[model samples]
Target: MEALFLPQIQQRNGCSPVQPAFPTKVYNGHSQETIHLHPFMIGPVTDTKVSLTISNGPKTLQLEVDLHDTVDQLKKRIMQERKFGGSESISLLYENRELKSSETLGQQNVKNQATLFIVHKCNGG
Candidate 1:
């Protein structure tokens, strides 16, 4: 029998395991610049932590949210903690990136001990 290798699975976007190519840039000697690139790794299936930082009025509060939930569910938890109404809007940021309400915590590809930024909506006329 011939040896068989497991096929590489594709991401949700249907893209294969294609490597990213970085183009070289030439800069003037007098100018100084810094370019930072973080390599993305395929994380294991594990329980992740969701942290939140909120700006309510003039104070900032930080709290931890459970990752076994959707973004909207987390918002409900925050609302309860802050004693805010259920209709109050909120925002979730993952890795300094913003996520929509329809998105879930796991769908964002967050790993263990991930820090999520929670911002309560402050509406002013």
Candidate 2:
């Protein structure tokens, strides 16, 4: 079976996951300046408590979940708690990263005390 992996970091769009998507800058030895991406990211998905603030439109939901759970599971829980019928239309965005359904919370680099934006996917022609 394929391992469920989520993007780790603060993407232009925000979402949830095990990795913490904080941005980092590296300085080159030469006078020339350059920006670089980190090879890996991390999150606080351990025994420690992780709090997430989910915002959907005018409504805001605060959820606490285990790091071991999958992102899809988190979506289900959110839909159940919010009484949202259209789970298919929902997507979790945090720090510019869109959380994939097949990935786990740890894969997405979701960190403690991060704010997630619950938005609907746009339809295209």
Candidate 3:
């Protein structure tokens, strides 16, 4: 009998596993059969966290966030941590470029342990 093994399918960032459309096939002489593997054999997806260091001049802060978290959410976290007033405008910069509030960390290609800069602007004098 001959057994064929297929390569494991994984999604980007190794966050999840993709199942194949067909099951393992075993061939013996003039006969063929299929075997279904248990779902536990495929393993489970682990929760991956992205850590970022945000710097505002001499002060710095560390944040743990998900890849799907948007820049706006991150800004809110920063505001809460820093206790900034509502009139304060917060800007996040990664690699010297300003990050959009609607964009996610994954969309921005922000890797773990990446350093970001914070710029604060107060509306009205």
| lDDT agreement with native, every candidate | 0.58, 0.69, 0.76
Most lDDT-accurate candidate: 3
The best-first sequence of candidates by TM-score reads 3, 2, 1
Q: Per-residue lDDT of 1-125 in model 1, one digit per residue for the tens? A: 33332233234443444344423332444544323323355777654665656544555557675556777776776777764446667777777778767667677775555555656668993
What does candidate 2's lDDT look like per residue over 2-119, in tens digits?
Answer: 3323333344434333234444444444534333244453565347457888887777788898766787888888888855446556788988978888887767788988888887
Among all windows of ten consecutive residues in candidate 1, which has the lowest summed lDDT? Answer: 1-10
Model 3 — TM-score against the truth? 0.64
Candidate 3's residue-wise lDDT over 1-125, tens digit each? 66666455334552444446556344555644333343345577756588999888878889999989999999989888964445378899999899989999889988899998988866685
List the lowest-lDDT window of 10 residues for candidate 2. Answer: 1-10
Q: Candidate 2 — what's its lDDT?
A: 0.69
RMSD of each: 16.2, 17.9, 8.4
Model 1: residues with Cα > 4 Å off, grouped in runs: 1-68, 83-87
